[model samples]
Target chain A: SQTIHQWPATLVQPVGSPLSLECTVEGTSNPNLYWYRQAAGRGLQLLFYSVGIGQISSEVPQNLSASRPQDRQFILSSKKLLLSDSGFYLCAYERQGAPHEQFFGPGTRLTVL
Target chain B: QQQVKQSPQSLIVQKGGIPIINCAYENTAFDYFPWYQQFPGKGPALLIAIRPDVSEKKEGRFTISFNKSAKQFSLHIMDSQPGDSATYFCAASQITNFGNEKLTFGTGTRLTIIP
Candidate 1:
């Protein structure tokens, strides 16, 4: 069984506010999507990745941006948000040729006061 | 050189004692190596992986000791459990050119198994 969903589990924006984070995967199909960032103890940082539907690939370059708009959906955006942009935001998946098993989602705790 | 160096950021054992976490990497084209387990708000699981012709890899209580000419790698925890505490990550994989696969994380190791 596959399941991965992420949303406003926790968020408190401020300082130029504007950001959207959402990731969904119910039973898989296309797969291979990722966007990770964990700071506050620091480690995991990959920013963006996608392989189908509009395609997107970015690995650390700032303000944040990612969109797959359907085909399992995946979106992580920002029009303005900084204060280091806060922390803990992860969404991952893999299966397009395997890519060494990656499945995680259940995170999104951004607090940019 | 993608860099992946991790070690004793924090560790305290007691329940049966035996905790070791160490990682070292600097590209070398990185074949693949993974280890992750986080539990404090969640999201970071997949706690065993090794590939580089495999020097050692166990799956029960966790054990991975690989050294492809000292590119170094280690993670050992046996007889240890306080529910195994949390936070421990060490990853290195390179296969991107948009072909898929890319992960380089290691700046985490916060294991505490006191009971």
Candidate 2:
């Protein structure tokens, strides 16, 4: 069975501070990874997605960036966080071929003050 | 442009009642339609999905009805329970130029089950 892990489960960052959120998937290789953000009572917004190492496609332009440093490791980072960055960040993974059912991690709740 | 649009931003249903959520897409190339359920403070989980080739698919108490010509789909939850109360999201996706998949999500609908 594959499992996805994300941390820290909750984060409180001051405005203009740096941000780093990590996601790792065990028991799967070369999986497609994605980052999504959801505001309270709103739909999810796709931020970035990575097909392979060093390859990332950003959907919306914002204060955040994503990187696939390793095959099973993905990181979401920000140089200086903004107040608008506060939301629930989720990391998901899917297989390479057909029937791509995405599996999500526990997610991180980011609060910027 | 919002590729997918979901209706009834919020729904309240009684236990054992059927709750339906609808979604419509603008892109014809979208071949996959998926519904996700998310609890508070938790990540969204894949609940059910359907391909364009199929008109309907069922899994346990959940069902997805797809209309190819109208580019519309819906999720039906039978005998809803309080545990089923959560936010539901409908999404559409197609194969990208790089062979990767990208999903466009609709505005989520919050479902509350009244016991």
Candidate 3:
């Protein structure tokens, strides 16, 4: 069985501070990874996705960026966070085949003050 | 273009009732439709999915009905319970030649069940 892990489970960052969130998957290799953010009372928004290491596609332009440094390790980073950057961030992984089902990580709740 | 549209931004139902959420897509190329359930502060989980070739698929209390001609799909929850209260999202995707798939999600509907 494959599982995704993300940390820190909750974060509190001051405005204009640097931010980093990490996601790692176990029991799977070369899986598709995605980054999503959900604002309060809003739907999940796709931020970025990666097919392989060093390859990333960003969906919406925002203050955040994503990187796939390893086959199963993905990281979301920001040089300086904005108030709007505060939200619940999620990491997901899908198998490398047709009709793939996405498996989600525990997620991280970031609060910017 | 936003390919998927979902209805009933919020729904409130009593226990033992049924809750239905609808989604429509503009892309004909989408061959896979999936429904996801998300609780407060938790990541969304795949609830059920249906392919365009199939008209309907059911898993436990969750069901997905797909309409190929109309490019529409819906999720129905039977015997809704308080534990079933959550946000539900519909997604569409097409499989690439290389076998990679990317999903485009709907705005999502928040469902609440009263005791």
Candidate 4:
């Protein structure tokens, strides 16, 4: 079975600090990856998605950016974090041909103080 | 604009009671509808889904009922248990030639099943 993994299960960062969260998938190839943010009492917001290595699409404009350097490795980074950046960050994967069902990782809880 | 709208921001039901969550969409192009379950501090998981061609789909204790003409769908949990307490979200997507890559999700409903 395929599984998604994310690092830094929980993070607390000072304002203006750089941020880097990572996500990697195992047991699948050429899968689509996505990044989302969930604010308190708000719905999940799409931040970025990648089709393949070096191919990324931004769903919403933000200081955060995503990169896919390897087939199964995806990274979300920011040079400087803002208070608004605090939220629950999630990473999801959809099979290459089966896009309707998406599998999500454990997720990272980020608090920008 | 929000493409998918879900009602009853929160719901409370007794164990063994049936809890239904409803959702409606405005886009006719949408052909796929899915329901997801999320636990606190955890990512949402796919519970069940349905296509426009089918009026209903079921898996285990969960069921999805679709109304294409009404552009609405609902989730019905049978014999609900305390363990079923969590947040549920309804989403819709239009399958293009490439596939349904993007999903428009509803705000989500928080459910509590008390024993």
What TM-score against the true chain A does chain A of each candidate get? 0.33, 0.97, 0.97, 0.98
Best by DockQ: 2
Estimate the lDDT of model 2.
0.92
lDDT of 1 at A4: 90
Ranking by TM-score: 2, 4, 3, 1
- Stretches > 4 Å off in candidate 3: B96-99
In terms of docking quality, model 3 is: medium
Enumerate the candidates' DockQ scores in order: 0.29, 0.71, 0.57, 0.66
Per-residue alpha-carbon lDDT of candidate 2 for residues B35-54, written as tens digits (9 for 90 to 100): 99998888999999999999
**Candidate 3 all-Cα RMSD:** 1.8
How do the residues A1-113 of candidate 3 rate in per-residue lDDT, one tens digit apiece? 89899999999999999999999999988999989898754567778888899989888988888999899999999999999999899999997762469888989999999
DockQ of candidate 4 against the true complex:
0.66
Answer with 2 or 3, whichever has the higher lDDT.
2
Query: For candidate 1, lDDT tens digit of each residue in B1-110?
Result: 33898988899999988899999997889898999999999999989999989999999989999999989999998999899999999999888887888788898999
Of the true interface contacts, the fraction found in model 3 is: 0.49
Candidate chain B TM-scores, in order = 0.34, 0.98, 0.95, 0.95
| Residue A4 miss distance in model 1 (angstroms) | 32
Q: Please count the clashing residue pairs in each candidate, in the order shown.
A: 0, 0, 0, 0
- The sequence of per-residue lDDT tens digits that candidate 4 reaches over residues A1-113 is 89999999999999999999999999999998889888766678778888889988888888999999999988999999999999999999998877799898999999999
True contacts kept of each: 0.67, 0.70, 0.49, 0.60
Which residue pairs in candidate 1 have backbone atoms (N, alpha carbon, C) closer than 3 angstroms, thus clashing?
none
Measured with C-alpha atoms, the lDDT of residue A35 in candidate 4 is 92
